[model samples]
Target: MMGTIQNRDKFLNQIASRFNRPRISSPIGKPNWKSQPQYEVYKGATQDELLEILKEQCKKIHTNFVTTDLKDLPVVVNDVVIDFGGGPIVTWKDERFSQWGLDSLMKQEWPEQNIDVFEWDYTVGNENIHKAEHANVGITISEITLAESGTVVLLSDQDKGRTVSFLPATSIMLIPKSTIVPRMTQAAVKLREIHQRTGHVASCINFITGPSNSADIELNLVVGVHGPVKVTYIVINDL
Candidate 1:
């Protein structure tokens, strides 16, 4: 009996070894991923150098750059409903949004300004989340960072709803510069790991480089047509 068992194990091992193939080696082609001037140029920058590069890239994108501090955002979002889809560390829960709920933040910031903020569960695609797109702006959280390319990844997870990031005329995202990665492959690997464990794929994962812009009309160059005319990325440093 022992001999037979040993033989069976040996046979299985031999079969495994004979048929086992090395992992597939697929090569990504040029233009295989998103392209950006910022990433291409700063291929090998140290942490300190990266910070300077990020600041420069950010300044280029945002004509009016603002710090990650919440106090600074209200001034920029002058007349829009900010959907503070949580997961961002907020020091001032004292705000009306946190006090009465997200709905009240708009009411508090600018009484006349029409604002609608709410928290949604990401596991299930809630219908309310879709409404944010109709508004002039939509705000959400970020998942990955791209230091080289100056890009941010938005995972449609529970803490941060996906609709809040896409459906609005302007999509404002909060990303910490520290999370920035050099390449898209690194970002994809991180996302895959999250999906594998969570067993849920974000409805949409957006890689927003800057504002929604297109030069389609006779090459005239127009912005904010298909999506938010503006994409305000708030990079928090301290938090």
Candidate 2:
């Protein structure tokens, strides 16, 4: 849940009293930096250009990248599921799936194909995690796409469980072209804007770069040791 300090002033006042200084409750203005290089990378690049950068980064990260329009998203997603050894799939309970014409694909069509589909339900609690653990694939949509690092940001909420992206053997992230940004700098600014406007942001903001990789064991690079073994990103061009 989105939350704020219940007794912020009281808590700070107690700390100030111990320090022997008066509490300064007013907000401080941000200092101007001498150099703001964060905005310089891929500056002024169009969405298409950003997509190209993301594609290149995907190769380096060992992530499969595919581009499609809204018209073919369902087909592309279905194909990816099949390619990854068709589910038993788990996905967040996000409305966009229905909004983008994927409701039937998840709810009806996949089941018809004898593919078990599980949507995270907060009311069901731990059952969600169990389903994700056993699912062949987990699918989710990106809230923010980093073109430079080929990362996708996921904001956790009641309906969007983190396990949907973490537990499954294969993971699929749906990216809308419009959500693609140059890098982390742009993504951070967007997040700040959201917090400034709403006074709160998601409790957990995940910056997932491809799938989980680790070299902790004898310096040999291993993939999917801690997360999904295979990762595929489907970028919707006309979303």
Candidate 3:
């Protein structure tokens, strides 16, 4: 056993030395996302104008996509099952909760509402979380963002859990427009900050844009095989 351990250590050090590993350079300066075709820049002389512009731009992405302040989210989402088992864990006393009023929103509100609450952990979720897949829409908060690709990032960590984003047919992300940056490089920097502050690296990090789509069937496009078929992002902003 001792000999095996020594050999393993030697081999590891040899591999590490051969590669001349160096610390990754910190991201600096502006991001390259401005060059992407999908990126849209919406700004106004006033913050209120920016909010309206962003709403219109976001609505154009899909018919089902709706941009409303969290306060405007209907008390009841009709005909949809929502699961909050492994979503974000914000302060119980925060104003953020007032917008969605999630704790107050009840499954009983919908005649056909199905709601399941699950534990937030690293393993596969319980039956309640899995049952969330039957619902047409799923909502969750983002852990980070990749500005260049217009991608929302989720890490399998404590506050922002993973399962909530992957299981539903339609995923709705409530992102604050202020968090938006210019590129993926800036995103990496933000992630590093999270790691440094939290001292925990996420097991899985997902970068999702739009819906779960594929074009693998002899030149035909398909969607929603492994994840949500439709992805709608509601860019929430304060004007």
Candidate 4:
């Protein structure tokens, strides 16, 4: 045991040498994220301007975007689902979707197109979860949107399943305009504060920028190699 300890310490010292540091240094400043200047440019922006920046940034990353009013949400969602070629769809089980009329709209549109739509159920979710992965379209709610990076944050928990985004061929995130943040740093700060207050985080907090891509095979570019090839953000402007 004494010899093992010496070897471990020697290995760590060698690794630190590459960085030209003998030991780790204590972090500086208050734990408060306000001390960090990473997102000040965005956190200080006007709401309207932030929305515009989000749209522009999303386009740059090849994410399709659409703005709709509260009443028009169902219509827009239906359009996106249809455009993705009408296949099996996986969606949320939350009743809040009914409040938005998304549930009824999907029922009406999917059946007419001869497509099957499944809602995520936590109690019996494990056995059938794999089926959701090959769904033609996946619709889920987003907690936050980072405008500068065109990223949408999906905070998954018991009620919200992770497969809603990872398993689908096309992923559609439903977000409200109010959830949009100016930058990723601002989002990170908010998340840290939430964890400090609650003492726990959900199962996952997904930061999705765009569709999955890779250039590993033959040095050729490929999209959707690991996940969805097409991603759409449906921002409810009046939310």
Top candidate, metric lDDT: 2
How many steric clashes does model 4 contain?
Answer: 0
Writing each residue's lDDT as its tens digit, candidate 2 over 10-86 gives 88899999999998878999999999999999999999899999999999999999999888889999999999999
The whole-model lDDT of each prediction reads: 0.55, 0.92, 0.53, 0.82
Q: Give per-model CA RMSD.
A: 10.1, 3.3, 7.7, 5.3
- Kindly list the per-residue Cα lDDT of model 1 for residues 61-177, writing each as its tens digit: 542233444554455444223433322211111232343233334446444443344445445455545555455556665578665556778765445555565566666665555
Ranking by lDDT: 2, 4, 1, 3
Tens-place lDDT per residue, model 4, 133-229, is 7688988887788888889998887767888888888999988888888887789887998799989898888998888878798998777776688
**What residue runs in model 3 are displaced by over 4 Å at the alpha carbon?**
1-5, 12-64, 74-100, 107-125, 158-161
Q: List the residue pairs that clash in candidate 4.
A: none
- lDDT of predicted model 1: 0.55
Best prediction by TM-score: 2
Please give the lDDT score at residue 7 for candidate 2.
86
Quote each prediction's TM-score: 0.57, 0.88, 0.60, 0.80
Q: Which stretches of candidate 2 lie over 4 Å from their true place?
A: 1-29, 197-199
Q: What TM-score would you give candidate 1 relative to the actual structure? A: 0.57
Distance from true position, residue 33, model 1, in Å?
19
Tell me how far candidate 4 lies from the true structure as C-alpha RMSD in angstroms: 5.3
